[model samples]
Target: MRVFAQLFEAIDSSTKTSRKVAAMVDYFDRVSDEEKLFAVALLIGNKPKRPVATTSLREWASALAGIPSWLFEESYYAVGDLGETLTLLMPQQSRPEETPTLKAVFATMTALRKYSPMEQRETLYTFWTTLRGTALFLFNKMLTGSLRVGVSRKLVINALARHLDRDEATVAHQLMGKWDPLTTRFTDLFPQQGTALPHHIPYPFYLAYALDREPADLGDINNWLLEKKLDGIRGQLIRRNGELFIWSRGEDLLTDKFPEFGPLTTLLPDGTVIDGEIIPWKDGHPLPFARMQTRIGRKNLSAKMLQEVPLVMVCFDLLEYEGRDIRHEPLLIRRAQLAALIDNPALQRILLRSEEMAFPDWQAAADFRERARQFHCEGLMLKQWQSAYGVGRRKGDWWKWKADPFSIDAVMIYAQSGHGRRANLYTDYTFAVWDGDTLVPFAKAYSGLTDTEIKSLDRWIKQNTVEKFGPVRRVKPVHVFEIGFEGVQASNRHKSGVALRFPRMLRWRLDKTAAEANTKDDLLDLLRLYGQ
Candidate 1:
């Protein structure tokens, strides 16, 4: 735990990726294989489940500290971090304690669930007293099941790859999918050379950069293949070794999540990997993104749900065809191959082709970008026809020209402390729009304000806070801001009767007043216009 704490501090404090990887490698060099595996898992958000609920821990901690629950809540609001707050409030030990190993601490968590309530309280009280500083903060994080640091899983994988002298992509593939650090050994995970990957696992996805200039700046429009930028999950549907596998961009295997696509294994031939969008489509057009979340949010789909959110994999590019790695082939060739694979009637419904658009010039492409909202798409994706499918985010091959977001003027109703670096600042805000004379909460956005703007807002929030509710503050509805959103949907769950998709602060519209802000009617008009 102390070693992990040291590594966490070193990694979290460092800004550069090289320094982060160095910190990980430095710790890995000293730790046992089991400890190293656990470190990887912890870094990648695979923390042990909470042995005891945070509510129980909090109640016990407040009682133990001889502090009122209200005082503890107030402290938590100020700190904005659950783990660090609890650690600070708890009484220290009488004598210094030996630091436990990472594996030992994790073992204690698994053992804690079986203990009686009183026993659990005693165990936790002792931990609070015994653990100190960064270890305590990290302990609290693990206990809460959100042990995140500054480093990414990619950095951890890169470090492991460098340490073991293995291919980075190979190491990344090895780390994918579910594995218990307690049972699955480091050697077992990364086997000796010549071990074949499980056929279902997907290759690294090829992402595109945003197009800042007109398409004409990139040369001829004939050299580009244009497709509607889908507001859907980036997915890889693989038909390999006579089995089908669906994977999200997050590397989560969604084979069971969307059981409707299980039949595609039989439809597409073996050794075919298609990179495309997983979208909820009913007729010819896509349903709203909020509608798609209905399917994605559930682990198990009911019969009614399956019918309600019928998703189609809009197949576009072919990575693997006929048991050969064809990613090096030009996208033009890949598209033709993908088209041929989905030509069958069986695949027509299950695997829809992401048909390319014919544009005479860049002007036509720009025109299409503005009208993307009609099709419920974000905007245009321009791919170089001759460019090979590059790994990760490469600049030359592809570009995404997203449409301008729908803007509205809304008043900030509430402000809350954010997590990570922004934890100390009141960055997150709940905004409201007019409803007759009342201000009804519509959306809560946390990003899009500049650092200078945020710092200035934070000072103002502290000075003008009208009331406090745990970590959130009900602020005076005096500031009006321009809020930008991708889409809107009618939702019975919200007071505004409509929900904004990807809502964020465009700018603090100092020019406007709360009285002149947008109304519920305005949001409803947007819902009718775009939430089809």
Candidate 2:
């Protein structure tokens, strides 16, 4: 535990990516088999279920320390972290000179496989209480899923192979399979050395970063492919041993959510891994994101919920197919193979593709993306035909070419105090545009405002409130600011010429004069540019 804690501290303190990767590699080189496995799991972010209640940590600390719940409540004020409070309460002993490797700890956790889920939870909680402050913080960070250490998964994978004296690619491929550090097979592979075996897990896609931009000069839309940015969950579909497993981009297993797609296992070739977006589809067209959101967290959805949000898996890329890795294959060729294999209409479709003639230049792609609002698509995706599925945002392989957000400069017409810390001050804002020289409010925004700005404006809003509308207080329209949005569409419900899509206050423009605020003409111009 102390060893893993030190590794975590090393990772946390390292600012450079190279340093962080080295720290992880060094830690992996030193831990036991079980601990190594657990460390790997922690690195890749696979943990058991979390407690249902926010106060569960406090309960664990209370029970472990033999202190009453009230005592914890009082101490919590002094030490904000539950684990920190427990560390302070526990009796001091000589710190162990030999810290167990990540492999050993993970092996221990996994070796107690006979324990029930409740027992496992209790055991984990007990283990957490025994750690020192730094170790405890590291464990909590890994458990909750954010390490904040800036190392990339690719770098870590490389470091692992370098330390183990194995092929990095082979090691990376092995890491993707089922992980259990304490297994006899795992222990045998690494031997019971200083470290057992490092935990191996798949990397999260959303967190991957791209290195560079595609040249603004790629002519011919055929050289690139544009995809609708579907407002659905991103997922990776993995097939092994005649069963299909659907994993959300958030790393949540969504296999049971859409049981209709269960038949896909038999249809798809062996060892196939596909990446694409998952949305609830019925008949032909797409369903609202709200419908899909409804089916998300429930362990077992009611039959009614499944029937309502019946899902469709849109296969986009064939990462691996039929015991063969095709991620290195050209996208167009892989796409052709994908179409031929998954002939089910429910599985594949030639998504609206841009004509080869239209996107001969960046301006054209930008124009098409700007007009994508008409087709209910978010933006475009640009891919190089020769690029490989190299992980960690390799340049040239892929690019998400999104249209710049729609924006307008408007005047702040009202403000109010936010809840919790800002309850005594006004931080929320109601903004307006110029309507024939008159200020008319169209939308209200609370987020995107900075803490310093919120507190400062909160004081002013309270002093300048001209009128009250229940919880909202109308204030003098003296501040002019810029707001950004994804898109704009006509809305009869709104008094303004248009309604903003995902409107967010970008920044304060105090230097600008109130007369410079957007006018009715400006709104009309934006509505026209919305390409409806």
List lDDT for all candidates, in order: 0.86, 0.64
Cα-lDDT of candidate 1: 0.86
lDDT of 2 by residue, 1-532 (tens): 6876777677767678788778887887776555666666666655433332336555765776688988877665334344345556654435443344455444444444556656755765555545557665554543433334445557767777777777665556555544444453544443433442322223335222221454465545567665666657777787776777887766667777777768776766667777777877776766756567668867788889877878776666777777666777887877777667776654453221222224556776667777766655566666766555665455555766655677789998877545423445566677889888688777677788788988778778768889876456788888888988775666676567576767888888898978898876687787786533
**Model 2 off-target regions past 4 Å?**
48-133, 136-150, 167-169, 177-215, 299-308, 344-361, 406-505, 508-532
Cα RMSD (Å) between model 1 and the true structure?
A: 2.1
State which candidate has the highest lDDT.
1
Q: Local error of candidate 1 at 164, Å?
A: 2.1
Winning candidate number (TM-score):
1
For model 1, the superposed segments whose C-alpha errors exceed 4 Å read: 111-116, 298-305
Model 2 scores a TM of 0.65
Per-residue lDDT tens digits for candidate 1, residues 20-101, read 9988888888888888988888988877998888889889989988999989888888899887788889787786866788
